[model samples]
Target chain A: MATTALSSPAASGAAAAPEGAMVGGDRKWALRWAYFFLCLFAAFALMPPLYMLITGLKKSSEISAATNPWWVYHPTLGNFVELLTSRAFQIFFLNSSIVAVLVVAITMAISIPAAFALSRMKFWGSGILATGVFLTYLIPETLLFIPLFKMFATFRDWTGIELINRWYVLLLLYPTLTVPFATWIMIGYFASIPRELDEAALIDGASWTQTLTKIFVPVALPGIIAATIFAFTVAWAQFLYPLAFTTSEDQLVLSVGIATTLIRADVFNWGQIMAGALLGAAPPLIIYAFLMDYYIAGLTAGATKG
Target chain B: MANIAVRDRAAFATTSRPRGSAREFFRQKSTVAFFFTLPLILLIAILVIYPAFYSVYLAMLSKRMDRFVGWSNFTFLFTRETFWMVVKQSCIFAITAVIFKAIIGFIVAHLVHAIPNEGQRKWRGMLLVPWVIPPALSTLAWLWLFDPSYSAFNYVIVALGGDPIPWTGHALWARFSVILVNIWIGAPFFMIMYLAALKSVPAELYEVAAIDGATWLQKLWYITLPMMRNIIAITTLFSLIVTFANFDIVRILTAGGPIDQTHVFATWAFKLGIEGGDIPLGASISLFMVPILTVAAIFILRDINKRGERI
Candidate 1:
């Protein structure tokens, strides 16, 4: 490095060689500093989950063994093996999968047609309606869940259909969270399509439904995939609603199930809890690993391109 | 002369017509649009619109939802000390967490941006793992890390001869723990957004500024910030609502513990309504968030409208 720093000045063959060398040195240090902090922040960002993996691999005996918490002396897959075999954990995974897939279907059914209409077909108050769609997308689940809980109770009271402890009943509630955002993103995607292709279809006497199914749906597959990923992840990661609504062992999704079941009394099953958390997070994490570009594109499109 | 002109115009209109009026009206684009949007409108009405109004109705009623008791529930809340504490804590938590998330996101974005494009993708993926993990599940990981008896952090600290801090035990540290967890989970989102914004910036602006003797900081202040102002406003406003209405981190970490010091509206509302069995009171507290969130939502919508116009 020092040799290059010295060699560059002679190679330049300029009167300001020394000054240029100094500037280069300063710029090199700046880049190094950038890398230094980049790594520091990356460690900060990645530490928790990595630690979860580390902790989950060790037995409770090792965790409480006064050894280095960061290292596992007796490394074992016992935690993973045990969790993978547990009947309750299996139930949690199954429940989460069922809810996520059903919710995705509901989200797609409601949002795709709506987005196509809003984007391609103009109406009296389409602009205002579009704005309202975006507004509802911003309403966080935290604010909506409580009132939703009451509304569900009211429905049950009126009809005597028991939904409080049923897993599939989440089908009724999860769309409230998924559909708005899905529709909003889909609207942006459908709008980004050029008008002429659909216009030609319309002029050729194809109906609106035909245009959506034949042209728009196939073209906007990336948007549909993006929305599907969003809905699936939201349904999978949801904690509060499941915790509040479903109390039975048979009904709990993986997220609420892990937090409630494993940490009974003061006997914190740290290993199994970590394993469960990781397993619960696996679907979104794997999807993100594969579909990051579409994921990010969808995210930014929903935000910056709205 | 007027009658002749009128007759000519009428003839022109009738001859120029392409289809029957009723069929044309039925086949209108607006009609198609309404039918297409009907399912979505129904879902929004039953799920979103109804519950929002119901929450308001609940805030004014008794615990049982049988009869209205005016603003008694809200008035009762205003008199509670814990309610006041929660309000202050929610503001502090959201603002502090957001500020740190923004700052950290900005710095990390610039750092990542400075690196070669090929390397940035790997770094971004590694960095976004926190974001990809569900917050509830992720918070479980955090909860274990901050475990009082066996905190991994405190082990390191104690080995270095300092006292092990109670991360979620005391009031201030509990607040710090929640905020730190929030920042950890949220900063990557900000980083990804800001990085995209940075990518949109024209590189020539930096070259011009550099030629004009602008330092790195000055160029960032002048070129990077102003160009990204719309995005910055939109992201911050978006984060504010999400942070204010955040429940998972607080719920799992402290459960609004250490004398109810960490309670935000969502967790606090859950405590009262679901656990405490005062549905009306909980609904009222949740409704309190509506005003601020509504304001933020409006700004974002208006900003998006403005952005849409520009596009």
Candidate 2:
């Protein structure tokens, strides 16, 4: 995935040819057959998401006993309509949107500058700071949540400033996940910028601040978008932070919200669960669909740069 | 005129102090540089660096910090009944899944690369959809596919005149189920990486091999494998770190169920720390993950540094 960032430019060059390019002889026939099987498996691999869409469109009663489980008999928009209008689902979506947007903003704010400094400055501990930023990538969210949760609990007990079960709590916590990779990515982007431009800005009496803001930021726009999307996806789909810290219904993001709210102990709500699954998946899927090339470039840069 | 000349002389004296010393200071520009980087330094310190050290601190103390027991919790982990099983299961889950994903990904990537250019993009995009979908939602679809009574997998097996296997109930089967899901989620990464590596292999090498009368297998062994060595090594290491640390697939699929026979390190830690309230033990368990992941990180860093020299 990280290599996607590095290889996308090269990949686009290889992929930009016309469809009708020919392969010759019986070998071409075998090649076509091989493609046929691969595409078949690809379709089969794609069935689950398609099934979720099909199941989500079915009503609960029709889903349970429908003779053709693969096909929808009485397809209705009620499930989508209901979930859209439902207060609980709305809260889940709102929380997700807020968290994703805020995390992206915060990540870019911290990482872009940090990346620039690491790339350009001869400051003390620059190497250590750069290494520290990359090493944080290895720390899983699960490892941090327990200690963070305990720390937050202790703070609540002492100062009566409760950080748990609030959407804003993620504002502080998500950086642990987003900033490191985002910083690493921006370092790659900033390193690619010509040093002459910065030197020119300095000669013209621009402060380092003005140089970064006015010069590098505009040139690194694609990197920023890639980092933004990465942060957004992480925040939106994150399961552990929301599950461990924000357990309340209204506070939950889409990932934990659907898992906790839609299903019960004895009986799972297959229809509603699939419905929530599709809805939860849509934002990132839509984003990926549009910006996959840039997303890949961002990830590869972070990976290759690290 | 005398006052103005005196002022000009004072300004000239100030500017003449051999701009060398001050020029040298400003040349590297460490002070100005630090100003641009302060926010990042402060954020990582407060958020990442502090908490990382905090975990180690949490591990040294007993619950509630009432007692300080150095390495007692670490020893206690070995004494616990579920500890060894989790360590074993996590190793099996991560290693097996990574190997299969690498193989499958290589094959699919080679196949995708064989296609005409225009067909390749759409097919590659389709191949990558599994990775694009959120893991939680995709894993739910997997959960339903493994539902005991009415699984899509069981339906396919029965339709083929075979008995239904308990995909997530039995110990070995549950482990296999999780690994299978991991492969499904992870293989596309291998495909993408290998595809990139494949494209980087110059066409001239293959043409030369063909001119020398090399067979398909010879071309793969002699040209393709050697060309992709650096990327393959790095991608495998990357996948190993991610798969080893993976918490979601196991948690969502089994939650270490059917008598807790399926718990990996991350899930075991979660069960102990969050569910059972044993923060120290969980931290200790998580610490065990660091050594392997560190080695993986080093390889990745080496790979990245080598790449930096290239492009």
Pick the TM-score winner: 1
| RMSD, every candidate, angstroms | 5.3, 7.2
Residues B217-296, candidate 2, lDDT per residue (tens digit)? 99999999988888888889888988998888888999998788888888888888888888887888887887888889
Which interface RMSD values do the candidates have, in the order shown? Answer: 4.4, 3.9
lDDT of 2 by residue, A1-306 (tens): 899989976765576344423333345787888698778759756888988898788888886673566778889888888999999999999999998998988888888877888898767788887877787876677667777887888889999999998989999899888988888888888888989999878655566778889999999999888989889988887887887888788889899888878875577668778888999999988998899888677655655663
CA lDDT of B225 in candidate 1? Answer: 97
Instruction: Give the residue spans of candidate 1 off by over 4 A.
Output: A1-16, B1-28
TM-scores for all predictions: 0.93, 0.90
The backbone clash count of each candidate, in order, is: 0, 4
Candidate 1: deviation at residue B224, Å? Answer: 0.9
lDDT of 1: 0.88
Provide the DockQ value for model 1.
0.50
